[model samples]
Target: MTTLEPAAVADLVRNTLAAHKSLFLATAGSTGPWVGGVYFAESGEFTLNLVLEDRGRTLAAIRENPVVSVVVSTGSPMQPFLQAQALAEILGRDEDARARELLVTKVPEAAPFLAAPVTAVRLSIRKWRATDIANGVLPGAELPSPRLP
Candidate 1:
């Protein structure tokens, strides 16, 4: 088993985010836990920006419970993995411009569909767990919530 310092862990997380464009977001809805794959962009340190339908189940679930879980992986065994619990803040229409811009810039194909009836959600990571077994960091390690930017 290998170990990683907090700074290294943070860097690893950032690198993982930079290498991936989408993550699995899990939220608790009135019905139950709902998971959705959303394209994301790192808006700031420890903050991720994603757009979702304003009236979609994911957004609805976020409104009901602002705390959500997110996972980013390559669908491979355990080489790259990041799981985080974050506080979800639904951006108001007026405040979502930047988020939309970031998303569109990262995913140009999504531009036309980002118009009205859609809004941005910022996930502020609270606690996180990560591992890169392929790199020899076996098992995994959980880190305390890093400082917010």
Candidate 2:
């Protein structure tokens, strides 16, 4: 089996996430785990910023449990992958305008939702597991988690 250093993978993940516009977010609701595709704007520290419906299941889940998982694949599934479990902070309406501006800048289709009542959620990446899919191994197989402050 091939092995990768956590720090190297972590840097690669940061760069890759910065290049991608969307990610797959996984959250748990009362029923069970649910996944959604969301377009996001990243913070300089790699935190993910996105606007979510205030009454949506993801908001409910975040309110109930602030830990969420995310997966971002570069270019294609066969490329490098970055997976992490992050801390979710549900932002108040006061932050909506800035969040909406950031999101709409990347995904223009989200402008309509910004007109509606929505809450912005920021996912602060804690640790990541990475893999290179070209080698046919699980992206985040058994590498040490690269934690962020």
Candidate 3:
């Protein structure tokens, strides 16, 4: 098993995050596991910003359990996609301004959606695993060692 260089893997992850419009967020709830699609913007190399309905189940679940999994993909076999393990947090009012800017900058169509009652979320990505068959990278080939520093 050959491990790709960290720089190469980082670039793949960054490009995938930039090209994708949304991500599938999976959280554990009292009922069970729940998954939902939500628009996101990369706030940093290891963090994502999201605007979710304040009363939504996803947020409710996050409040109960901060650990979550997120996937950034278009569901195309020919393209690259990434899976990440992250810790979720509901941003406070003071942090919302910056998160909102990042979201609007990435997805202009999301501006109106911000008007509704919603809150900003931050996903602190811990590890990234990616697959790019087009690049001859098989599944799990790009998994980071242990976790991101």
Candidate 4:
């Protein structure tokens, strides 16, 4: 069994988001169907930005089921064997105004997109978990005897 330090977990989340420019967002539609997409970011935040029109299923899903999961990976085919996989989970909904503001930071290219009908949302992270797949153990598994930061 492995243990992950708080700092290590935070770093993994940040690095994973930064390294992977695109994210596969999964959402539920009005009828309880799963919808997913590859979305670009204008910046890194607990929240994400996308064209509202493009997220018909997502929006409806959020309305019906606000609970959602976001998976950010290294996109490495060798990830499984490595024992350490970097990923983050964001749970919540995006607030239009707040999401738009944050989006501008990561994706300045969305300036025009903001004006174009869009729904901005934020994912409030209720709980987060990170692991070092390479270690073949959970996060923080190999702690130094001294427990150095």
TM-score of each: 0.90, 0.78, 0.91, 0.62
Model 1 agreement with the true structure over 1-149: per-residue lDDT tens digits = 77988888778887888888889999997979999998898865478899988778999999999999999888786658888889999888776888999988888877876866788989999766888998866666676665742
- Residue-by-residue lDDT tens digits, candidate 2, 17-119: 7777888889997868888887888765457799777788888888888889988875476787778788889877677667778888877887787878778
From the highest TM-score down, the ranking of the candidates is 3, 1, 2, 4
What do the candidate models score in CA lDDT, each in turn?
Answer: 0.84, 0.75, 0.85, 0.50
Clashing pairs in 1: none
Report the poorest 10 consecutive residues by lDDT, candidate 3: 139-148
Candidate 3 structure lDDT: 0.85
What's model 1's lDDT at 9?
A: 78
Taking the candidates one at a time, how many backbone clashes does each contain?
A: 0, 1, 0, 21
| Whole-structure CA lDDT of model 2 | 0.75
**Candidate 3 residue runs with Cα over 4 Å from true position:** 1-3, 143-149
List RMSD in Å for every model shown.
2.0, 3.2, 2.1, 7.5
Candidate 3, residue 60: lDDT: 88
List ranges where model 1 is wrong by over 4 Å. Answer: none
Residues 44-102, model 4: lDDT tens digits = 33434444444566666676676666555555533421112112222234445666666
Q: Where is model 2 poorest over a 10-residue stretch in terms of lDDT?
A: 137-146
